[model samples]
Target: MSDYSIRLYVDSDYEVTRNLFRNGIIEHHNKAFHHALQRPHIWLPALVVLTLPALNLVSVTTSILVVLTAVAAIWFYCRYMYTSYVDYALSDDMLDISKYYLQRDGFCFWVAETRGGEVVGTIAALPSSDPGGEKHLELKRLSVATKHRGKGIAKVLCRTLIDFARRRGCEAVVLSTSLAQINATKMYEKLGFRQTHSFYPPGLLGQFLDFKIIAYRYDIPAL
Candidate 1:
């Protein structure tokens, strides 16, 4: 794989970075759905419900309704999440690009580009939201184009964040990611980030997502 250059985000990179993030999410969602179809955990529940009618435990009409309800719930939940994510991103730094991230204190955004100047990835380091968390930095919006996987673009972005945090006197760099991002989880682990916490979306959404959200942190040594 050819090396990609990493640098601070520029005004011209706004659209491409947004596209990379959006497309990365869509790609992950598609891959997750395909994986779910093959997983026994997902299929087994549906299978049990379908077999109930044959066993006379549920009437045919009720069985059909049950199966359809389950399918609909999953579909609607995925759609809700997708819409919520896009809205959240659009309403924040991702939309304004400059005000929230560029002008904000202790927040830095970066873009990775090929030698030909095609932007392929992006990442950010932002100040922690916790009131007393001055030493902590939050890693946010890390993404690379689907076709660019296995090319070390993600590693470069991650390392850039780590180095940036170290230079900024950050005690640690943390991020929250979902289980659907298996490759990202692995990459973080390889980069020496430890699993520090797990979180859920809350209420019905949490139930649907099965509490897949997790947190990872990397401790930075003082120079």
Candidate 2:
């Protein structure tokens, strides 16, 4: 809806980004992140880059080198974020989303929304109902402070996820959402993550249904 800037996650941003990620997955939605959050190798380099904090005492020059190295590694990561965007932006497939939010000086992020264009925007559009709702892509997790909802950051993040997923080789995208996040539901529909008449419990649904939240499948096909 509005304008926003995107960047990679630097080593200095490890904890902030990680927490944002964890929260997005664990807090708002408890669904598996694109099959599994850790399954994607996209986040490992950033984790490896962050291990340098313990070696900070090795030397000032070494520390600076590590920081710079981490920044470059992070820049390379920025490329993935962009690719993921491309994958979902132009496809009829699922999406992978990873991102950060601005904190006092850094960022905190943890919400990924995926949609497939093949599906309709609401349950009425679906051909029929199911025992557990229609199936869809298990996008990634996402979270934002209640104080920051109406600002439309989530909308930007949803679009970012679609673009990112498209870049990652997806034709469209899908997700399992819930009513606990009514505002987010509206955002998803607004962005084309239509409901498809699916029913998602209002609790986190892990790979094996690990949490207590309901979820609905939202899909976004190629544009």
Candidate 3:
């Protein structure tokens, strides 16, 4: 038997849930910075900067400082972008889970709690906003506490959402995850979700960084 129980969101879960969302999203900044640095466009410039000292154009210390400054700038930019996303999400449906999800038909948020009654994870399902996919559900806000992961809490939470969708007669369950969420993508695939498409997130920063969001769908088989 599982040690965790999944239940609908309650007013008391606000603070912890928000923190989970913020930290879970922000935690990817480091990975994103690393991924950004791996891009030729980004690293090539740093490489060129590093060669300056060898070319006798700049002192070794000066070259190192310039490269470090560029890396710091990229790190800060990634942090800012993620922070901005979290703020926007908090101001959106996440601002009031009860009002946005609990009260709406076919939209619900759930929290996973341990036997000791500690909230360890969160997941939400909402009607797909895409045209012609009204029967589909979009899973969102799925996050597990760092220390609590690898205990199958995330899988349980996903299964709970999937079961809920199936009972609601939904045609499919879909979710969008970013490249920085490599583990999440792998988990989704393990749960039988197939990649439908991918696109860069909206905004200039996303385009410049070449950050992409992959969409996955799990189609329910006919009963």
Best by lDDT: 3
Q: Candidate 1's residue-wise lDDT over 1-223, tens digit each?
A: 3568998899899889888877776556544444445556667888898889889899988887987887767656665665577678867779877777789778899998888999999998898876666898999989998788899999889999989888888999989887678899999999999998887776765544453678898999767
Q: Could you tell me the lDDT of residue 112 within candidate 1?
A: 89
Clashing pairs in 1: none
Per-residue CA lDDT of model 2 for 58-148, tens digit only, reads: 5555656775675555444333333443344323211111221222221122232123211111010111123442332234434543444
In model 2, what lDDT does residue 145 have?
Answer: 39
Which residue runs of candidate 3 sit more than 4 Å off their true CA positions? none
Q: How do all the candidates rank in terms of TM-score, highest first?
A: 3, 1, 2
Residue 68 error for model 3, in Å?
1.3
Error (Å) of candidate 2 at residue 116 is 35
Ranking by lDDT: 3, 1, 2
Give one digit per residue, the lDDT tens place, for model 3 in 158-220: 999899999999999999988899999999999999999999866787876767789999998
Candidate 3 lowest-lDDT run of ten: 201-210
The residue-level lDDT of candidate 2 at 200 comes to 30
Candidate 1 wrong stretches, greater than 4 Å: 30-45, 55-65
lDDT of each: 0.81, 0.40, 0.91
